[model samples]
Target chain A: MTESVITVEHGAVAYDDRPVLRDVSVRITPGEVVAVLGANGSGKSTLVRAILGLVPLNAGRVTLFGTPQRRFRQWWRIGYVPQRLGAGSGVPATVAEVVASGRLARRGVLRPAGGADRRAVAEALQAVGLTERAGDPVVTLSGGQQQRTLIARALAGQPELLVLDEPTAGVDSASQDAFAEALRGFVAGGRTVLLVAHELGPLAPLITRAVVVHEGTIAHDGAVPEPAGHHATPGHEHVHPHAPDESSGLWGS
Target chain B: MSLFQYDFMIRALVGALVIGLTAPALGIYLVQRRMSLIGDGVGHIALTGVGIGLLLDRSPVLMAVLVSAVAAVAIELIRERGRTPGDVALALMFYGGIAGGVMLVGLSGSRSNANLMAYLFGSLTTTSPQDLTVIVVLAVLVLGTMLVLRPALFAISHDEEYARVSGLPVRALNLLLAVTTAVTVTISMRAVGLLLVSALMVVPVATAQLFSRGFLATMLAAMGIGLVAAGSGVWLAGTIDTALGATIVILAIGIFLVVAVGAAARRALVRRRAVPAGTAAAVEPCDVVLEPAPTSPTPALDLDGPDHAAVPR
Candidate 1:
């Protein structure tokens, strides 16, 4: 049996006396690209965060690679790309330097980046097709390029599982198509991916399963719905008119 | 040349140089975190420590560090409790410290107002050998902590949630920042005085942020700015016979204004030149895909770190 890379059994999460996710359970096994689809404030981000131990699980349990979430220590195994932050939240960093941060867990602190670290950073940059822009400051890049820089950072760790939160949001279609192409290469290596996106878009073909989150619970879990036409040519003008009422109300046109 | 005629003058210069290097070295973290006023708050708290020292006939700076450290820890704990904004806690401490120090100074049995004033506006020409030794050792220790924990510190400062999920020790690192800020403020009190020390820490770093694109580059530029500001300010103070601490701070601010105004003028010129050609670097980005890079051994599970096991109290 393929080992489950992530498992959240009856997990519940709350923030300041308000429940965000309740009785949420999910299991991501090796090599499956599972997209968590949901409307805004439907607890999708919270679910991923709980599974990764970003938010404290108030009830039930979470386990990473079979170890209890609290005891789970192999951080390098899981690479994560968070949503874009405010422009002011960041110190100006180059694409290479920010991507190199992914290797921090593997190499440890104090020692300078070595040859292996350099090679991984180089490969990650190449994978994202940002090899040419590696020397530019991250802020100088467009939002899509900055998103690619973050993905490259996660890829630099060479993690077994990658968790991304709304990576394609506000990005241009060309960058989206490129990201999809790079993801194909990553999945070819038997890596598992837990993706949180509003619409699969360019990534529709790569998703092996879809888990829809609604109002803090798992609403649907199975094959990708056939009618969304997300597999069409990439363009920001593409709209998901057929998305369920809940998600359409939140993000779809 | 005559400035070197007095050993006291030489000592003051050394103290200013040392404090200048370390204040902004640590200040980069505070500024990135948007906790710019933290140093100011802690400096106020240290004054109470100075007052306590005067009452007990002890080294006021030593007493000030102890008080500031405790206040730093308290600020962190209050922040962790999450009752209000961090600034509220800081403002509370800032005012409480100033008020407490004033009260303590009045209550001090010996009434050594001169010593108290020395810490308020540093006696630049009064640095002793012992003071120099303490400043040097503490400065190295603070800078070393920053260097050794660079990645972890950067990670947490950038995104607390992401760092926590990555198994980085978030709480311990926060506490370490607190300790360092307290120490930085304490050591700097002797060079620029408590009131002006934060300027030494902030202005040079802010100046560097104007154009530097990466963390290390900004840090290096800030250090250079600080060195020039402090070193030149000391000599300028000696040359012109001005107040030493105030002159150093004014020099740092002067450098900031030059950079800020130059950057603004350059931006205006670039817009005029580039707008017609559509050659601006402002293109929208695209989506990212993660499809490959597997087949290696499973990542090691060891989670231990420099301060992982000990939970911050």
Candidate 2:
């Protein structure tokens, strides 16, 4: 059997004395697109955060690329796309500039962006179909385009594993298709993906496995669950019954 | 040009240029992190440091740097804990700072309120040769660090979570920024004054954002605006015999207002010209597809059930 890219054994986490995740274990191997699904307040996001060491786990251990997470220093091997754009922090940063930041890990803080870094940034932008808007300030882009810009930033790092938290939460359909296409290209390179999502829209087909989290534990870990009812209909306006809630736990609170 | 003949005037101008260049250079990151007002809080704390220096007969500039650096780190810690609202923590520092400075200065019998006023409103024309030396050394240090760490600083300020996952050392960078901001405040004490130092740090960046489209462009533009404002303000204050710090701040604000009005007017003009063309490009009607509606409401899938799983490859 191939070694897993990510390993979580009996993982648990809590925020402010309130338990958010408990006794959760997941293993992901290379080239697999795994979806983490759950209702609001179900600790799905916390699970991913725990794996990435964003939040402290109360119990259990997590390893990345066969190395213990705490000892893992090879961050350039992983790309992370956060949930949403933070309005660019009221700063005017061009698309290319933001994407170029992804190379900081590989390029180091003191060194300037070399020729290879520039080419990687440019290629990432092109993969997301944002080459035309490379010169525009990120704040000027639409919501979906901003999302694409973020994806381009993650891609610029050239990581083997990509972890995204709801990359399509508020994106438009066209941009979603573009993102899906970008993911298709990423997976074609034998990369791994683990995402936390409420509803898998354009990205549903690419998912190879599913891990369902219901109240801080993994309820099902196998094949992706097929969408039933309105979700099964094409062009049905992607709306899930789960009202966006405080289930985001540490991040939302 | 006659102002150059005076030794004090030349020193003041040199000091002004240094503060002008460094304030906004470091301020850009603070603005990016939405901590623009942090400089103001640090400035207040530096006042307490100045008071301590006056009491102990130590170099005020060095003392202010030390005290303000400590306070700034405390603020960063408080912000990281997130237990208290950022503004509340700043408020505590603001009141405690001014009060401490006043009380300390009072306790020192040799120094009077006039001495405190020099640091409060600035006495640029009285900048001693030693003060200039300190200013130049500290300014170079600040500028060098900012240049070398621009990428990491920009990444952390723009999106901290992403920077952390990238292994860029977010906490250390944040502390470094806090310390840098403190140094900026202390260095500007002789030119823009502690009270108005934040104006130099924030206003120029705000002014530059009006037209800049990228982070580097904004920083360069803000520094340009700062240099121009500081230089002209010093020159004009010498010519008119006005307060140096107030003059510089007012000049920076004047530039901001002019750019703001100009930007608004240009936007209005563009809108007026585009109105006609915009209407002409209205969307044309397209065919609509109708699908059959299901008679019964479909049951929500039981995601927790293993039976609902997709076929395994």
Candidate 1 is graded, for docking, as: acceptable
Looking at candidate 2 chain B, the ten consecutive residues that score lowest on lDDT are B304-313
Model 2 TM-score (2 dp): 0.90
Every model: iRMSD: 5.4, 5.9
Off by over 4 Å in 2: A229-253, B83-87, B276-313
**In candidate 2, what are the lDDT values of residues A27-80, reduced to their tens digit?**
999999999988777898999989999998899999999999999999999999
Q: What value does the lDDT take at residue A109 in candidate 2?
A: 78
What's the chain B TM-score of candidate 2? 0.87
How good is the docking of model 2, by CAPRI class? Answer: acceptable
> What shift in Å separates residue B98 of candidate 2 from its native position after superposition?
1.5
Model 1 stretches with alpha carbons more than 4 Å out: A86-90, A228-253, B81-85, B109-112, B268-313
Tens-digit lDDT track of model 1 for B1-313: 8887888888888888878888888888888777777898899999999889888889987898899999988887787666558757678789999888878887885655776677887786887899888888998999888877877777777666666766777898899899889998998898888898789888888988777767777677787888889898889999999878899999999999988887766556544554443322223222211111121111112111111111111
Task: Please give, for residues B1-313, the per-residue lDDT of candidate 2 as tens digits.
Answer: 8878999999999999988888999999988878888898899999899889888989878889999999999999988877558768779898899889878878776557787888888988999998899898999999889888888999999998889899888999999999989998998989988899999999999998887778888888898899999999999999998998999999999999998887666556555664554444334332211111111121112111111111111
DockQ each: 0.25, 0.36
